[model samples]
Target: MGTTTSGCCFPLRGSQAPTGPEVQLCENCKRLVLTEKEVIHMARTGMWEIEGYEMTDSSPDFPKLKESAENGCDFCLFLRNTLLSPEVDFDADEIPRIRKTYRDAGHQLLFHRAGYRMSIYDEGKLWLSFEIWIVHDATGDMELLPSLSLQDPPKPRVAPSQNALQSTTNLFLRQAIERCDAYHDKCKVGRDPAFLPTRLVDVRDENAVRLVEGFTIVGGDDASSSSAPKYAALSYCWGPRAHADQQLKTTDENIGQHLFEIPMKGMPAVLKDAIRATRELGIPFIWIDCLCIIQGNLQDWEKEAGSMHKVYGSAYITLCPTMSKSCLNGFLFRDPPSIVFPYHSLNGQPAGMYRIRFTRSWIWKMYLTVPHHPFAVDLISGSWVRRGWTFQEAALSSRMVLFGASATHFHCRTSRVTEGEDTETSVSLDDLGLFPLLPSTLSGDKLDEAWKHIVASYSQRNFTKHTDAIAALAGLAHRFHSLREKDEYCSGMWLSQLHEQLLWRRAMYEGISWGWFFNLLDPELPERVLLHAPSWSWIQRINIDYQYIRDSVLPTEPEDDGSDGHGDMSITPSPGLTDETLRLEWRLPGKSGDESSVVDRFMQFRGQELEITGFVARFPLANADKPLEVDELREADTNLFWKWTISGQYFCHTNWDFLSYTSWDRIDKGEFQHLRMLLLSSGRGKSSGEVSPGNAASSDGNISENGDVEEDDRTAFGLFLFPTIKESENGKFYRVGTWHSFCNGKGGFVRFLQYATVESLVLV
Candidate 1:
C-alpha cells in the first residue's frame, strides 16, 4: 500500500533492478526504510496494513508498473493474472533485458511451483509469451521479473523436469508452514478425554531420524507443557496386506525392541514419501497408524484408535496422498501434470491476440466461495476418494496439503490455493481461487446434515476390513458431537431418527438400481463385509447407495458433499416420536439357527406386532428410480413370488409385504425371481382426521381437481423390512440380493410413528 516518494518510474528505465530501499523511501519524512516479504505478501493480498508504513492505493500503468518491483509487487502480480495479449507488436528482447536487469541487482523471479521457477508458453493467439527469473545474487533476494510479450517470444532453453518439480514441491511446503497455518492461534490445544501417549517419528533431521526410538507424548495439559514440540499427521490407504516379511509393523514382541532398527528399505513407499515430506516441511514429528500403534496388540490398538480425534486435530498440518490408490502406487511425481488450452481474444482480433487458459471451472460460476475446477475435481474423484478410513482424516485436520495426480493442492480453515494456481488471487477462503476443497470452517452446517454428509461420502468408500466402518469415522464423529446436540450414536444411525435410519436399504437393494451398480447381486463377493456391527448398521452392507444415506428420509439429488466432496447432504426431518427403540440380538448368518429352526428364520419379530392394514403394491424393478404408484401396481393383479434358488426346493408367495407369507410353494411351482414390495398406508394417517386422503392430495395440488393422483410419494421414504441372509441359510426361505428396499409415500418419513407392535427382532 506504500507509494513512491520521488515519483520514480516502475520497471525502472535505468540499467539496474529496483531496490526496495531506493523505491520505497518515505514521501513525507524522506526515509529509506523498506517492507519485508511478509509485508509485501500481505499488501499483494490487499491486507493494506504494513507496520510503520503509510497504506495508500496506487494507480500505475500495467507496462510501467511491471517494469519495477524487483520481487514483483502484488499490483504487478494482479495485472499479470488478468493480462491478455496486447495489440502492439514490439519488445522481442524484453525478457532477456528484464532478467539481466534483476540478475545485476541480485534478485530472481519465481513461478507458483516450489522454488524460483519459470514457464514460457506459446500458442498462436496468446504466447503467454515469456516467463523470467532474476537474481540480485545467489544468496540475495530473488523473484519473478515482470514478463513482457506483445508478440511471440523466443523459446527458452530449459524444459520442465524432476529438478523443477522438486523445487515447486519444496516451495509449496515452505509457504504452507510460513503462511497458511495459524499454529497455536486456533488449534485445539486442550488435552483430550484420554491421556493415551503417542509415538511420533521425529523427522526434522532425516539423517538422525531414529524410529523405534522416536519421540513420545508427555506431560499433562498445555498449561504445564507450554513448550511441547509440534508435529504433522498422514492420511493414506494401507492397501492390501503386503508380504509380512517385507512390511514393517509393530508387533507385541517387537514393541520395545526392533522398532528403531526397522530399515528404510523395508518401509512402504507411502511411509517413505510421508516421512520425507514431513522432514522437508520442517515438522518435528509425525504419526502413522501401523508403525506408531502396535499392530498385533489389541489393547494398544484400541487405545490409539479412541484418541484419533486429538491426534489429527492437534497436528500443525496433515499430508494427504489423495491420488494414490495404494501404498504401492506411491506419491511425489517427477513432473507436475497439467492440461493447457489456447484462446484468441474475442475483441475481433482472432489472429491479432491470443492467451493461454489454465482453468476449466471458474470459482465465481459456482456461486460459492469454495469452487471446483473440472481438472481438480476429476483428479480428486479417484480410487483414493473411496477409502473408508481417510474420510475423518481430512475433516479433523486444520490444514492439509493434498498431493494429487498431477499437481498438489493446499487447504486450511481460512484460505486455499494450489501449486498450479496463482497464490496471490485471493486473501481469504471466502474469495475466489483454484481450490478443490471445502472450507474447513463450515459456518452454517447442520448437525443432521453434517452426519448425513459424512455417511453419504463414507458409505461410497472402500474399506479393507468392513469392520472399520464406524472405526474409520471415529474422529469425524468425535468432532461432529461438538457441533450437534448430545444425540447417542446408534451402531451407525442416530437415536433421533433411529426408526427411519433402520429403513435404510442399499442403493441397489432388491436388484433395483437408479444408476449403474458396480457389484453383483450375490452376497459372496470378493470383498467380504465381516459382520462386526448389527445387521441394521450400514457397516454390514457393501456397495451402499452413498446418496441415499445422506438424506435417507428425504427425496435428495446427486451431491458430492462432506469431506469427500459430496454436497447438500443435510436432512431436515419432520418433528416426530422417539420414545421407543427396537431392541435386538444378532449373530453371523452362517453361525446362527439350526435345521429345525429354519421356520424361525422366516419370521423373527419378538415384540407385540400390530398391523396397520395398508395397501400392497409391487415395485417396477425396471423403473426403480420412479416410484410405482398404487394405480399402476394394482393394475398388475398377478401374484409375484420370491423363490429360493440356492436351496432349489422352496419359494414363498406373499401379496405385497415381503413378510406375512400367504402360500408356500416349491421353486418349480412358481417363477423363481427377486421381488421388491411395499406395504403403505391407504391414506390411514387421516383415519383420526389429521389429514384426509382426498384433502391431502388436493392441498398439495399435483393431481387434477377431479382427484387423480399423478405423482405418488414414490420418491418419499417409508418403513422397510427384509429378512436376513438366514432366510437362505436354514434352507427354507429366499435370500437373493444382499440389499433390500421398500416403496411407499411414507415419504419424508422422519420416524416410524405407525410401526406395527413389533419390537425385538434378530437378523439371523
Candidate 2:
C-alpha cells in the first residue's frame, strides 16, 4: 500500500503533473506517496523543500497536513493511513482533496496504468510518476480517497543478523585453534619436551567460545569422530610443516652429541678430590662440561650453550683443581692407595667370610665413570691452559661433576696406564708426565655432518668473547680466588710482579721470557784534579797545616840561594817588645830584604806559634856585603803569626809533632857553625834514616814493638833563621830564637827550643 501526503490514496488521472502544491495521501489515514526520485532527492539533499501550497485553518485537511509535516511525516502517515484506515473507503471527489492535501504537504503523486502509484519531484515541479495499486473486487463500492496528508516514510534501520555474528566468531576461533594444534604438533617432534601442550579442548558454542582461554577450537566435531580434522590439524599436516619437521629432525639428530674432542692428563687426583668434596657437600648436581656434553656432537654443545648460564649460575660451589697440592694429587691419583680405597677383596674369595680382591671394573664404574652433581662443578680452566690445549686437570676434574666434561677436556686421556694385565704395556705421557697422551681430533672433519647444523641453529645469537659464556667463567675464577687463602699472598705487590712476569711470558710471547723483549746499554770512566801554587812561606794557616802534615813525611835538603840568606834580610816582630838586639827572619826561596820580603817572611810563620821580642829592621835593596843596621827597635805586628800560633797549638792537641829547626846566614853563605851547633842540640838535624817521635806511637796509644817508627807514623817541625843588614848603618848585631816542637802526650805535646843567630858587619 502506498502512503499519501494529504492522508489519502488516489488514482492519478492522465499523465499530468501535479501543480499548485497538490499532494496525495490516503483518505482514511495519514500517508504520503513518495516516488523513488523524491526519496532519492530527499536523501541526497539531507533536507526537504516543497513549493507553493498552504492549507487554510478552516479546511479539514489543514489539521492532518499540519500534523504530518510537524511531526515526522513518514512515521505519522504510516500510522494514520496504514494503521487507522483499515476499513475506510475513499470516493473519487475525496481522492482530489486527498491529493491536494498531500500536494499541499509537499508531496507529488505518480500514476501508472498497471495501478502502480508513487510521488515524484522533477525539476521545480511535483509530478505523478507511478503508483502501487492493489486489485479490488468489482462488486465492492468504489471508494474515494481520504482527506489525510501523507507523512514522510519511516527511515530504514540496518542491523546485522545473528548468523553473521556467529560466523565471524567462528573464523577467529578456527585461526586460534589452528595455531594451537600446529604448536602441539611441532612440540611433539621438537627435542625440548617443555614445549608440548598439556591440555586441549574444543569450544564451539558462541558463549563457550568467548570464555575459552588461549587457543581453542569451537563448534567443531570431536577430533576422533571426524574423518579429518580441519584447520589446525590440516595445518600441522601440510602448511610450512617441513620447516618445523626439519627443525625437529635436526634437534633429534644433534641432541645429546658433542663435536669437539678434548684431550687432558694429570687429572685423576684432582678429579678424586673434587668428587670427595662434592660428596661431602651433599650436592646433587655438578656441571662439568666435559662429561656433561658429547664430545663428538656440536648439537649438544649448542644446546648446552643455552643452559650454560643457568648451569653455572646455580652452582653451589666450583672447585679449581690446580689450586693446591691436595687437589692436584687427588686429580692425578697421587694419593696413597689406602686413602683412596680403604678396603680390598682378593680373588672373589671370602677371607674369614669376607672377600679381599679388587675389581677394576667396579672401581672404574664406582669412581672413574660416575657422574658428579650438575651444579657443583662450574669451575673452568683458565685461558692459559685452554689456549695451550692443556686439559689434563680440566678433563679428569670435570669427570667428577655431572656436567660430563668440559668441551675443552672431552676425550682427553692421561699418562697413567689403564689397569689390566700388561705385556709390558706402555702409555705416552705429556711433558709433566702426569697426563695420558691423546690422539689429535679436529672439528673441521665433522663440520659437514654435524657442526654446521648446530651452528645454523644458534646463528641468531651473538657470541662475542668478552661478553659471552666465558665471561661468567672468568667471574667464577675470580670468586674462587677470593675464597682461596693464597689470594692475599698472590695479590700482594711483590707477588703481582711475579704475576706480571707470568702474564707477559704467557700472553706476550706464548709462554716464553726472553731478553729480546727489553733494551740494554754499555759502561765508561772519570776525570782529574787542579792545583793553585804559591810560596810556601806565604801559605795560609790551613795551607801550613796541610804542608806541615804532608812535608813531615818526606825529608829533603834545603836548596841554596842568596835570596834565603841573612844579607839584605828584614826582621819584623811583636810591636810592643823593643829589643833591637834581636831579629826576626824566615828562610825560604825567592826572597830579598824589603817590605815584600818582610811580608813573605811573616807568611812563612803561618800555622807556627812564634815568640817574638825583636825589632823591625829593613835591609838594603841589594847589598849582600853591607853591614846590617838595626833601627830603633820596636816589636813588629804579630797578629798574623799569632792566629797561626793558636791554630798550631790546637793542632798539637790533635797529635802533630815537630822534628826540625834550620838556620841560614848570609856571611857564611852555607850551613853556619853556630846554626849547625844549635840545630844539632835542638834535634833539628835528622839523617835520612832517622824516625820522628810522632811515628813512635799510634793514634790508639799503642807503642810500636819495633824501635824504628813506621813511615805512616812520622811527624816533624821546623825553625828558620835569617840575617839582617842595614845599608845606612856601619855595624849591627841581632839574635832571633827559632824553635821546633812535637806532640807526645795523650794527643801530642809541643816544646820549643831556639836554633838560630846571625851577626852583621859594616862594610862602608
Candidate 3:
C-alpha cells in the first residue's frame, strides 16, 4: 500500500483504476457524490429525499470492492463510516459484528434533508449526519452558498501529528489576529491604550530565561513606551487539592527570584503550553494569574485580582485551555481528523491535493446554531466553565482561542471560527455563551438583561472559598460600573436597582442540596453574615434566580452625567407602583485614610448595610419565613397559616435546616414576640378586582381567624426579621428570610400593613 504525502491514509500502490467518467463505483457509493454540483444543488434546493442505493449481500466484484474500500478511496471511507459511527473509536474485535449486520442485511445508504444539514441512514436507521459544503480546497477558498446556509468549509484534513496540529493552529491564530486587527472595529485596540498589568511573564526571547517582569506602560509622545505591549492571558483550572503541590506560584519569598527567572522546566504543562502558544503568535508577554499575582500576599493578590477586568479585556488574545481540567494537562496537542474524504470540484473534477472532514452534524447545527442566548444551550462544557473566577476572565476578554475537546475554536467580537473550518461571521462570542461583548452604548434595559443572564449563570458555578464569590464577580461588576459610573456597587447588588435585585430566590436543583435556610443566628458573631456581603444581597447565596419585581418609587439620586452625559439611560417610572412604607438609606462604615492591610482596604467600602425607615409588622410568621417549632405549634394553634390556609405566597429563607412547631407555640405564648416583617416595597395588583372570599377559605372552605379577609388591590414584598438580643447587636436586626403576598381582596398583605407602625431600623 502507498500512503498520501501527508501519511494520513494508505492507498493501493499501482492499481490501474478507470479514469474520468468510467471510474469504478458501486451502486450506493456512486450516488454519494454522483455529480459534485448536483449534490450541492440538491442540498440548496431542499430535496434530499430520494430512492437511495442499496448494498448487496454478495457481489461478483466483492473482493475488488473490499480492497478499494480498505484503501484511501472517498466512497469506501463513506461506506466504512456508514457501517459504524464517525468520531467514535471501536476495537478490531467489534468490527466483525458491525460489518456482519450491514453485509447480510442489505443495508441501504439513504440521504434525508434536515434543517440546513443532511442526515444519512442505513437500513432505515440513522447512521450519521454531516454539514457538507463545496469549496476550492487548494486555496482554502469557499463560494458563497446562501441557499445551503453554508458559512465556511471544514478544516483541512492533516496528518495525525502534534507538530502538524501546532503549525495549523499557529496559521489560524495569525490569520484571526490579522483579520480582527484590520477589519473588526469592535475588536480593535482603542486609541486610548490600556496599560499592561502590574506583572507579566516575559516570553519574548525563546533562548533567554523567562521572568515575571513588572510592566507599567505610560502613554506619551513616544510610541514604543506609550503603546501597550502585545500579550496573551491564560485561562485554566488549577486542579483539585491533590495537585496543589504541583502548582507553581509567585509568593513573597520567591518574588525576588521570579523577577529574575521563571524556570520554564519547572512550570506546569498548561502554563508551558500557554507560553509556547504566546511565542508562536509572536506576542512578547503572557499573563498567568498564579505566576503574575503574588500568591499568599493579601495586598498584592487583592490589587491584581480586582483589576482582572483590565488584564483580560486589554489582552491581545486570551488562550483558553478548555479541555484541560488541571494545570498538569497541556492543550496545545490534539488528535488529527481521523476520517478523511477526497475532495472534488463543483465541476466534478478531482481535487486530489486536499481532503474534507464532516466537521458538524445535523444535531449540532440544530441546537448550537439557534439565534438565542448562549446560556440557554450547553455550548462548551469543561472545568473552565465550572470555575467562579473564570466567568469574569472569559466575559471580560475581547478575543479568545478556546482549545475545546473536539476542536480548536477562535472567538472575537465579530466572528467564531473552528479548526479546519472557515470563519463564521454571523456568529459572535456571545452566541457561544462564552462571553458577551456588550457595547459601551448599551441602554438600561439591555444592561439589565445582560446582568441577569450573567448572574444566573455565574451563581451556579463553584468557588474554593465562598468569600471569594463577590470578589470573583468584581471585575465584571467593575466593567458595568464604568458604563454607568454614577451607580454605586453595594457589595453585589447595585444601588440603582437594589429593590429589584433583592428579589432573587434560591434556585433549587435536583440531587444537589443548595444549602439549607437558617432561622436565626447571633448577630454579635461576625460569621452570622457571609463576610462583608449583607443578607439582602444575592452574593450571600449561591444559585439565585432573580425576577425583577416592579419599578422603583423610592427616592433615588439623579445620575451624575458629568458634563458629557454619555451614560444617560432613560428611566421610565411605573405608573402606580410605590414604596410607601420604606425610605431606604445605605450606611457606609467610616473609612480611615490609614489602612494597613489589602483585605481591609478592599472590604472598607463593601461592608456597607441598608438602613430602612419602614413599617415593621408584628406577626406570627409561617414555616417558610423561619423553621417554626411545628410540633409545639400544631397543638397550640390549629388555625395556624400552615394548617388552615395555604396561601400562594412565596418566601425564600436565608438559612435554616428544619422547621419545628416550637417557634409558633412560643409566639402564641408570647415567649418569642420579637419577630417582625419589614415591609420594603409594594405595587398595585397585577389585576384589579375585589379580594375574593374564597382566598381566605381552607381546603374544606372553612374560614379561620389567622386567615383574615380584606378588600384590597395591592401586593407587597418584604423581609422576615428578628431583633438582635446581644447588647453589642443593640438596635439592629437580622434577616431570616424574604416575604411576599399577592393581594387577593381577602387576607391581603397591603391591608395588613395598614395597621403596622413605621419605624427606622438597621438590617444586618
Among the numbered candidates, top TM-score falls to 3
Q: Between prediction 1 and prediction 3, which has the larger lDDT? A: 3
**162-270, model 2: which lDDT tens digit per residue?**
1211333234323433433354332122122121111121223212211111123222334445221111100001012232122111123333221121122333333
Better by TM-score, candidate 3 or 2: 3
- Candidate 3 lDDT, tens digit per residue, 247-320? 99888898888887887767888888888888888878888998889889987887887778788888888888
List TM-scores for all candidates, in order.
0.51, 0.14, 0.61
Error of 3 at 678 (Å): 3.1
Poorly placed runs, candidate 2 (over 4 Å): 1-273, 323-329, 332-764
For all the candidates, what are their Cα RMSDs to the real structure?
18.7, 56.7, 13.6
User: On TM-score, who's better, 1 or 3?
Assistant: 3
**What lDDT would candidate 2 get against the real structure?**
0.23
lDDT scores for all predictions?
A: 0.40, 0.23, 0.52
Model 1 alpha-carbon miss at residue 131, Å: 30
Say which candidate scores most in lDDT. Answer: 3
Q: Give the per-residue lDDT of model 1 (tens digit) for 1-764.
A: 34432223222222333221212212321111112332233324522222222221121233433543335453333334432222010111112343343323333332221111122222221112122222233333323322222222222212223331276667866776567534423433332323333677656555655443323444322435644566678888765455223556777776565345555776777778888888777666778776788887887776677667778777777888765555654577532222121112223222111122121111111221222332244233334455667777766776677776435767666555656445422222222122212234443433444444455456756666655777777656656555554554555556554444544444322322211121222245444433434434565455333232222122233232233221232333322222233342223233444622312221122211222222222323332231212221111221222221112211111122222123323122222222323222211121112223422221333222343222432222333333333345331112122221111222221212222233333221
Query: Positional deviation of 122 in candidate 2, in angstroms?
Result: 99
